[model samples]
Target: MSESLATDTAKPLNGRLAPPRTARVVGLGHRLPDRVVPNGPIAERIGVDADWIVRRTGIRERRYAAPDERTSELATAAARRALQDARLKPADIDLVLVATMTPDELTPNTAPLVAEALGIGAGAYDVGSACTGWLAALSIGASQIETGRADAVLVIGAEILSRVIDPGDKRTAMIFGDGAGAVVLSADGEGSIGPIVLASDGGMGDAIIASHEDRIIHMDGHTTFNKAVKVLVESTQQACERAGVTLDDIDLFVYHQANGRILRSVGEKLELGDERVADYVAETGNTSAASLPLTLSLLREDGRLRPGQRLVLAAVGAGFTWGAGVVEWGLK
Candidate 1:
């Protein structure tokens, strides 16, 4: 972990007292599996045309992990790239937080395996907020830095949804993919990551679930879609307000890559133009927890993300969990 003083409070934003210390995203990386599963085959399995899949979910194809691939392997790969991008070694990380609902196993959790693979001795754990997991983990990592609990943290979001989706079930089969993404955060002299607003509605937990009987994901598409759009919009608004910025001030809007329709609807409600909102669901499908970070990596690779840009990140997931946050891009 990097050393830094924490006694001084950051300047207030719109009368909101910022944290005394802030965490800045210094590096980012993502990994997608080699296998590309197009909607043509999936559509045949579900008795729908390829065009129907695209129309409904805006997903033309998605990556699927090999049968031998483990979730931790993807996470470790992404984390290594993030370390390299940050110009830091594994030893510099004080904590490793992996957010994933699909762990390599239930007993040991995924973070430790990822840390071990990276040869980092940092304390590690998992966060299971489903699709909202990455933003939730980011909040946790940033909070640790803000309180001086740790100086450098490695936050990762990884998912192997292909293993859990029933190929015949159109609800999930057409929407899920496999991938991992990671970011390295370090304490900064001024806060770059802003307030994160998190909330949930467990009463709607059944809207998306994976029962023990089948260990396969089931979702009420209509219910999840309606609730997702509403929460995503509301959370983004709340995050902007907390950050002392208006919607117009955001340079980019990155929401969970759940569905193209959902993203478009959220943009319509927010009155944001297409260029301002990210729509990567078409390429990566819904990676659950990996969605947000994966999209972030894509943006960076395409040169859409730059230092000092303001961004709003948001997501809604099962457990009815949802979150949004503001970040000022810090990587050069």
Candidate 2:
């Protein structure tokens, strides 16, 4: 049969189905605390040299929220910047989703507080997947647009981890920071968002978990490192296949800023050059849910990202949660 005839036969009997609408990130913003804590103090408190902290985590300085700064406050600030970046007001948003594990208060969810502060009269909620929270929320927001549940949604990942980490615990004291990052997603005339893959291994959750007794973050560094590289590589490859693309087609790689060593290892295994991979851990230690989006925002601010570029985002969080997705940058 002729190629044209075969193409014509593939259409539905009634008519050709319209392509599904998709959510595209139209704006991005991030906010880090003004107070920057160098590794000196943290190392001293943990009875280690500053060089030891850097050699292990590749973190030189990290931000700590002020006494009055709460998770909600950081989230609100980031949201406002996102709205401004998209040239839209809070009233224009149809929904708000905050991806966070650290809430300002346990009684009230932080999303609603963020929405109220933004003066958005829309549905608001929270999603917790630890460091993978933002990617999970991105997938959810895209699905909402595809399903006609929302036209424009604001997604924020904010964390005030300073309040949660046990300062005396050397394992975590120098490895966490406080920050918030946000993106505005809305339906577009042309689809920009692509396939997303989310997975979890609850059985291995204990590898990276916070102790309930002491509320301190404990991680089997060696075990978690291996898992992170393997899962991240797998997830990214799956997303690329689902998006009908290849690894070489990707313009940039944005992975969760968990550890510098993990990032380098993943890049090496993927055979990707250093310039193709992003490294933000040196300036901001793992911010949990906020890491991915914060890194993205920084890229945008530095004029590193460009329109029509293909980006692959992957992340691994506590609970063994991990996700990857493809995005075609829609910004001008």
Candidate 3:
């Protein structure tokens, strides 16, 4: 996380510098389960009315994975779509990175399963940064490409938060959903992805946690809301500065879809109009790590994303982890 406007570079052991390389996003894909869970049922279970849920979180409905579906399945589906969008085959990928907090099992990791399902023999791993997992994984994948370690990498953010949220807990129950999203990064295009700024504060880890005893998510809403806004704003600014651009130069601001009120507060603080800030939380709820990429896919479907547009991405998650990055849209 250098505070400089330069592509990440690496040096060889012979005391020579490798030519600077850049990773560009060549494809995007996302998947949402068929079952739509509206706020009405969730509100009833939490002793609140549907309108109260809407006013508090601005989430009208959310998708839930079926009992037979697992995180790996969702990830594999999204990865296939991304591969198709990139016009790439399984063998084209050199590495696979899945950002997930809710994995299928406690032993075997999710990425390897996804790779096997996709018929890709590429090296695979998982990044577990909760909601900020996608941006963290994106930074890692881009670094691999920039350092000449891989030509193409598939980065995914998937979560089945419904499995972790306690149905009786209003704080966590009303705020989570299930889905997966993915992107293909390759060294084939111009340097479309810019510098990423990542940081964390472990002391605040208690703000959002799922204890092993109960295996249910619990959150201190007030603490998370205040800290999330502060960190998101700061990180976004830092990412822009490192990219040698200002907020005005960014075509869109895609913060983590944690809550609608938090998004609005961030926008008001940044003096950005509604047109500039994205608000997909109303429909997606909080998809945790899947929020960023899923929102990007939706934006593309709605024709809001353009090839030359510049966008800023930011997120703050459970570990009190946070990251932000700039992207010069290059997808065709």
Instruction: Judge candidate 1 at residue 46 and give its lDDT.
Output: 91
lDDT by residue for model 1 (171-284), tens = 878999999999999985333788899999999999899987888999999999999999999999999887767898888999999999999999999999999998899889
lDDT of 3 by residue, 13-120 (tens): 123343377789988999999899999888899899999988888899999999999999999999999999999999999999999999999859899999999999
TM-scores vs. true structure, each candidate: 0.96, 0.93, 0.94
| Model 3 residue 152 distance off true place after TM-score fit, in angstroms | 0.4
Q: Against the true structure, whose lDDT is highest?
A: 1
| Displacement of the residue 236 alpha carbon in candidate 1, Å | 0.8
Candidate 2 lDDT, 281-309, residue by residue in tens = 99999999999889989988778887767
- Identify the superior model by lDDT, candidate 1 or candidate 3: 1
Clashes of each: 0, 0, 0
Alpha-carbon RMSD to native, per candidate: 3.4, 4.6, 3.7
The reply for model 2, stretches above 4 Å from the true place, is 1-19, 189-191, 211-213
Alpha-carbon local distance difference test for all models: 0.90, 0.86, 0.89
Q: For this target, which candidate reaches the highest TM-score against the unseen true structure?
A: 1
Candidate 3 TM-score, true structure as reference: 0.94
User: Over 4 Å off in model 1, which ranges?
Assistant: 1-16, 189-191
